[model samples]
Target: MATAAQKPLTGAKVFLMLVAFFGLVIGVNVTMMKLAIATLPGTEVDSAYSASLAYEKEIMAAREQAARKWQVEARIQRQGDGGAVVQLEARDANGRPMTGLTFKGTLERPIDKRADLPVELSEVGIGIYRGSASAVAPGQWDLVIEADARGQRMFQSRNRVILN
Candidate 1:
């Protein structure tokens, strides 16, 4: 009976195997890295150092805002045209309508900063502000409401909302 001769393992073959293994590992790592970078949502603050430096100021502002006891209600409704409408009502602790303020609303996607939509609201009636954002995708969003009076921020609030 005759048997077929088997090929012997050589240094060159071992080197090729090692190179192929490492190549595959490197390829997968690069692809994963690309995906991660593409999907990465940048930091909330532009500069963490700067934000930290102003943390005390932010806290003070928040305290002042709380002291004012402003009642700011915000609603985001999805329109049939794939857009969204923002309605806001502001009042003081005494139930007086908050007027003479500039209202701004932002619809921010919880996961992607790039999907943030800014709405410039105008007072449709005293204390009632209305605005709209075009082409808003339906999903979970953070509604950031801010009211400014005399060129200074008077009230700020963030609320989570779901849109169908």
Candidate 2:
């Protein structure tokens, strides 16, 4: 059988291929970065320098907190109406139910800051506290809690719960 000779590759074809490949790569990278930045809510502190300035104080406070040996346990539950409630219990290191502490929490979607829900908890019985939030769409939620005694911070805890 006789066959026609194949044509040599042209510079324009190679350049076009390179352009398409690089264009796809760059496009995908840009899209991913945008999605990451948009979804990852950032910065626990507004000013990093200010936080660093107080770093020692924070460290000391953490040390003191640890020395106190207070323990806090938190739980999130789904209510029948589709809303959610947070239940918390506090105890001393020796395992006694702690009392006379004030509690506050926030219900937030990790990816969306606009859905943040602030909850003020009330002590129901002894060291047990209960707080509720309005119905939230089913997804992963972050619960940040702080417990205070007198006018000082006693303990802090975070929990992630999936409602669904």
Sliding window of 10 residues with minimal summed lDDT for model 2 = 37-46
Candidate 1 yields a Cα-based lDDT of 0.91
Clashing pairs in 2: none
Candidate-wise lDDT, in order:
0.91, 0.87
Expressed as tens digits, the lDDT of each residue in 24-103 for candidate 2 is: 99999999999988877775668999989999987888898899898788888888888888889888999899888989
Per lDDT, the best of the predicted structures is 1
Model 1 misplacement above 4 A: none
